[model samples]
Target: MMRRLCWLVMILAWSTWGAAAVEREAQRPAALSVYQDLGGTLNVEQVAALPEAVFRELPERRFFHEYSHSAFWLRLQMSAEQREAHRHWLSVGDPRLSDIQVYVPDGNGWQRMQAGAAHPPESWPVVARQPLFRLQATEQVVLIRVVGDSLLVVEPLLRSDGELLAQRRAIAVADGLTLGIVLLVVPLSLVIGFIMRSSLLAAHAAAVLSYILLVCVVNGYLVHWPMLVPWTSYIRAFASLVGFVCFLGYLRVLLQVARLPSLWARLYDGVLAAYLASALWVVFVDHVQGRFLTEWVMRLAAYGLLPLTLLTAWRRGLPLVWMAWAVPLLYLLQFLARYVFQADHLPWQARQESYSISSTLPGVALLTCTLMTELYRSRARQRWAQQERSQRRLEARGRLEAAVARRTEQLRTSLDARGALLARLGQELRGPLLDIIGSARRLVAMSSSDYPQRIERNARSQLELIEDLAALSHRDELPGPSLRAGSLHAFWREMVEEAELLAARQNNRFQWRLGGNVPCEVMADFGHLRRILLNLLGNAAKFTREGSITLGLDCLERDGQRVRLRFSVEDTGIGIHPDDRVRLGQPFVRGRNVEWIDGFGLGLDIVRQLLEGMNSVLHLADDDRPGSRFSFEVCLMLAGVQDVASVEAGA
Candidate 1:
């Protein structure tokens, strides 16, 4: 009976203490109803003077108004005992709010404390990423006003100092990590874009940069960097606009709109234009309306247009296009969940500012992977193309070698036949030609008739033609010039006589001109030189009828042991047609105008070949005197020691 009484006494004491504790907890301040200043014109004094029935209560502690033009007012009612028991703080969870003012009752009037993006962090009652204010011990009624252009989520929290400090620290850590990620991803995207020279990568980099800027502005990091604080509003607006534009541009490039069907391509272009126009509106027009337009446009692109475009590109053989859009789509969903739907109850909803900023990483990583894969595929294609080209070239070379071998064998056989035919012709024709020439000479000696001389000259010309044909056939086998010391004066006199005789055949007059500085003696192959001049003079003489032919020699330059001489043969006859000049040096090719009077057209070609062997080129100079002139320059060693020594001394 004594033990039972003791237990009952203990249980009774515990029950009384628990009941009192429950009553005390129920009395503690729990919920504070929020109110809106719909007109946004109410001052702290007016709001304080208004009755409690004037303001409408919020459904919860949180409110979201995208681009709110009016201010929101929150009235927290607390007893002096409750305020003293808990050293409370009024924390506005949004950092992007443009203006925040807290009114704490101070004796007879209100002591106002300010914190928001509008006021720099230095002036804040508690310096943190979000607006925080400490409530006074005696304050019973606190008025909080919030205003901004950004999407407003006013989550006013009444917490103790330790809870506020812990929240601030968590926010700081999240923001720091976000900043670190942005810093890492942005430059990396830029570098990869630049290195790869990829339009897709470049567009992605621009999107990342612009989106990060928007994230920084929205997260209220501008206050940390004071230089950016003044242009906070402008930065936020422009960053949002540019971010949307960049994302659309990235999608366009990734989809390769040019390769899409015409209708889809045009639709993509139209949407892109709309985005660009919205960005312009944000800059030059009202930002609030412009941002509203931009948001809708972004939603259309991100949710509707981009997916369709990706689908179109995928069907058209771009299999990886969907993979590229996956991360961005995920980011978009996250954005919708957090800002649009206000689903703060989700697991990932904590530290949403950090989540929004750091979400760019997955997209960047996806882009990097896509670019690397593309690079690898490109290298593979290049290697395959190189191998294919090499294989084709090898096959072509083998065919060419076989063709060349067959052609060489045929040429060898044909050359043997040509040699036999030439030998037979030489044996058969030379005897008759010799007989005809001997008879003509005898007839010429027997009678003073011009016909015998004509016959003899014709026979000699025929013999010369035959010799030119033989030379043309064996040109490649010909030896170099056999240089010998010779007198240039004597050689010139002999050439002049021959030229005059040849010219007289066509009733043409021949003239010779020698420069004053023509060398007296030179070391040259007179045989080849004589043949060259004979061919040119013969051509001139043969083409001209009752016209004049002139052969000129000039000393172009005189060095110590070498004399460069210019030789020219000019004819005042039917000049060579421009169209026929190009064919003049080809074997069996003659000027079109001179076709009626020519033998086999082997003279000029033979002249060209001989000049080539002697390191000279034949040039046809344009003459304004109704004639064509063929000129060539040749360098010969001065044979006379006295002449060379004189030239050296003069030099």
Candidate 2:
């Protein structure tokens, strides 16, 4: 394979080298005779009888032969009008062939024919600028009159390849190559695009159409088939313009710029319209070929659109960035070469060999490969994220199962302990109660003064302790799942009322200040929320014995979306120290101040756990609050909620 590739490389290199060599060799000037009859004294028959063999051996065989100079050659001293008419007749064949060197006898010397002149009137009938033509054995020259008798001979102006046939061939070849490449590239682009699942169908359609236009232009111009020139040129130019616009459109779609159209996009559209108008102008306007310069300008403008669109796409972080750059760059090089080289005359093999040997083909392949690689890399990254998500989900499920199992075990143990405690309490209480009641009854029956009163008081005190234990054991079983669509204002109002009651019970003044009516409604378990509020309020009421407490509510908005609801309850009593803050929300944790408080240290821990379960959060409001502000923000469910929309509209 390597060897075969190397051979192909060598063949391409040789072909390119050969084309250059041929061009260099072919462009050299060919030497020939020039003839002109400013004075038309020469006869038509004499001019026509002139040997055409001189034309073929340009710069080689110089002096042309006539049938043995003296034999029947015209010696008529014609007038200038006759000379002009005769020479004009000769000149009618081909302008490029009119100039030729012929031998004209002037005494013993021969002078060459000048361009547009066969000979000088009254002198020699023929002129030879150089004596390269072989003389016949019987040929002889005789002198005529001094100045007027001598025919003028001038050197033939060697015409450069007038038709530029080689150049035309080169151009034709180049054009054919371009068209062939387009044929290959366009179909291949679509095939590869399909394989890659590219959504560039419109752009690809434009490309194929553009390729067809290019093929038409190539056939018309390079092949010298001017009949197809006008229509094909219009189509070619229009198609190319549309192709560029379509490329821009692809970028716009790929980058999702329609979501937020930019200035560049509008301008790109304008430029594309202008390009189409320019193409249309070529069709309607007379002498439109003069506007080929304008077409070039339009092409340049189209070329610039690529980078501008690419820059815009880059700003938007489009996945097609590299493709955007590569696709245009590939075509740009070819476009530049096409115009700059003026390759109208290049041959097909030379042109194909040029582009094929260029880095363009491989560059295109590399570009496609690069895009594929990027897509693959993008997919790989996505796959990795999915795998990570799956792994995380599995880990989260395991932790959740463990937590459920642990909670179940804890509940079972707690239930068993409660049962045993209840059984023991019943046994102890029954004996004591029976004895006390019996004694009290006997005393009441005997009317014993002090014994009856003491027995009744002891029994009453025992009943009070048992009632307190029972009350502690059943503090309103923690809230169940009863979601309520309640207004934030209503919830805050209820929280304030509950906090005030708790504060009054604890001999504390809960300073409840409502900031404003937060119109947002939340969809959440009202019971769980009430428990969260109660824990904070109860903890505050317990800890802050004298000082006031403040609870605040705020709604937050971001990116035109309502996302959060913050609830904070602050205390002015001894603030939680920094060291204990981290430990505050742990189960069974008690700060020094907390240890001195009346109740268990499980309120904040329950609050934290409950909030976590509800996907709400609990945190210290800040590092520098005057006192502890236990705050948490729940993400509001915006679905089926209308307040957020109203608020946003008002804002």
Which candidate comes out best when scored by TM-score?
A: 1
Off by over 4 Å in 2: 1-14, 19-188, 200-209, 212-216, 220-238, 250-260, 287-375, 378-382, 385-389, 392-651
Model 1 lDDT tens row, 513-607: 99988988898987778878988988888778899999999999998889999999999888888888778788777777777884888788878
Model 2: per-residue lDDT, tens digit, 1-651?
A: 336545554655455555455445431112333233334455433554566442233353122321111211211122333333222111111111112333445454554433211223223222211111222223232111111111122122111242234433554454445344445545665665676566554344444445354434322232233233224445555555665566556545544556446676677577667666665665466324424534554555556655566676677665664555776675576565666775644433233223122323353344345445546766887899999999999999999999999999999889768756755685577677768877897788789576686566447545543543444345422333454455666667766766777778657777765545345465566556767777787677777767777777776542233456677888866778777867777756788755666666767776876787677778875667565788888765543456545544665
The lDDT values for all models are 0.73, 0.50
Worst 10 residues of 2 by lDDT: 142-151
Q: To one decimal, what is the Cα RMSD in angstroms of model 2 from the true structure?
A: 25.1
